[model samples]
Target: MSVDLETVRRVAHLARIKVGDDEAVRLQDELNAILGFVEQLNEVDVDGVAPMTAAVDASLRRRVDEVTDGGNPERVLANAPAADDGFFVVPKVVE
Candidate 1:
């Protein structure tokens, strides 16, 4: 999984990034180091380990599903350039 200068140059070209010869060489080394770290991580044993979204388990806070008026319809429509019958009035595009 080692990255070469030519591969780094190609990656830069595909990413639409400007990388000079020296910068490309540096990027090649950096990419190789990152790949090496990922390879090291692949050696770890995780058999039967459950995937987790957070470090600690906790129920997500939620509100009961209920219908309620948001209130302040006039305030919500105040910023509209044109509003009719509590709705935004836009130019008719279809005949």
Candidate 2:
């Protein structure tokens, strides 16, 4: 995945960023170096490695699923710009 100056310019344009000709050349070299590093990483043998969400060995703690009151109605409605009873009040859109 070698990147040329023209390809770098096109990428910058697609990203809606301004880049000079010199900067484009520099970015092309940088992108090619990154691709080279990724290629090198692909050569490593990890055939038996298991996919993991976290690097730590600790197991995630979870709680039993149960339904309960979300919060006290008075607390929830406290910051409402306009509230009637326990519900938020909004302008009537339809008659």
| Collision count of model 2 | 0
Residue 74 in model 2: shift from native, Å? Answer: 27
Taking the tens digit of each residue's C-alpha lDDT, what string does model 1 give over 1-95? 79778888888999999999888888888898889988987787889987788887888889889967688889899999999889988999899
TM-score of 1: 0.45
Tell me the spans in candidate 2 whose CA falls farther than 4 Å from its real position: 44-95
Q: Candidate 2: minimum summed lDDT over ten consecutive residues — where? A: 62-71
Model 1: how far residue 95 lies from native, Å: 37
Off by over 4 Å in 1: 45-95
Question: What C-alpha lDDT does candidate 2 achieve relative to the native structure?
Answer: 0.88
Q: Write the per-residue lDDT of candidate 2 for residues 18-50, one digit (tens) a residue.
A: 999888888888999988888886778889997
lDDT of 1 at 93: 81
